[model samples]
Target: MRESPIDDFWVRARAAVPTLPAAVPEAWAFGATATDADALLSLVLDGTKTGTASSLHDCEADGDALPEPGQLSVILDGSDLPRAVIMTTAVEIVPFDQVSAEHAYSEGEGDRTLGAWRAIHESFWREYSQDPRGFSADMPIVCERF
Candidate 1:
């Protein structure tokens, strides 16, 4: 038997900013860099705040479990002196429990809908069909800067 490779991916968005106050947790600084999705991925894997020297790739992924978007940001602080701020929102792509990857794909690339419910449904369903029991097409996830 062979284990099929699971492509579990999520996109995190962040607003670009310079420095965030040290009092604020690095996890919440995601809003400072919400457009750059890669930063969030780094945060997910390695969340230790390195104070200008830290990077997310440094973290260890012990298992294949996924990170909770809101929860994920809170667990880590990025490397920055006083911490360079990161405005981030995350989208995680995991192996479908029922829906196959062939069916789901991201809908909004350049188009912005101002976060209407219809827009949210379109985004999730456009990339992938609804999970019904888990993530549904009716409700949408809204990300913001911390």
Candidate 2:
């Protein structure tokens, strides 16, 4: 398999942070697209956004695996360069409607409210899928905290 952009970063990071394990990272991304990825990565670097969510079905559809706790991943910037390394501290699979206000707050996006998070995330998920049925309140979401 082809190495991801994150692989290059992992090599550099391990060199810089000698304490980091030598094992390869599981995955890495810039969070969303250009603008969104920059923003989210900033939040993570500044210790603002500690939580994120994704559509479980979307991952399955894309053949991308969901993250598991204890896995280490790199956070990338808009140019697909590494900005930070994050270790998954927790993972919760829940329906969209079951997402709590606390989780929304941790995302550090919009007004930091459940309504804002829901609106933003739902819109992203909907547009992310070509199918109209991509997003729904009952959709299973993977809520990850690091």
Clashes of 1: 39
lDDT of 1: 0.29
**Residue 7 local lDDT, model 2:** 76
Best by lDDT: 2
TM-score of 2: 0.87
Please, what's the RMSD in Å of model 2? 2.8
Which pairs of residues have clashing backbones in candidate 2? none
Off by over 4 Å in 1: 1-24, 28-36, 39-109, 114-132, 143-146
Best by TM-score: 2
Q: What is the lDDT of residue 24 in candidate 2?
A: 71
- Candidate 1 local lDDT, 1-146, one digit each (tens): 54211111111122232332223333333312334234543543453312111111111222222233343233323432122333333433322232222222222222222233244334434454323333443332332222
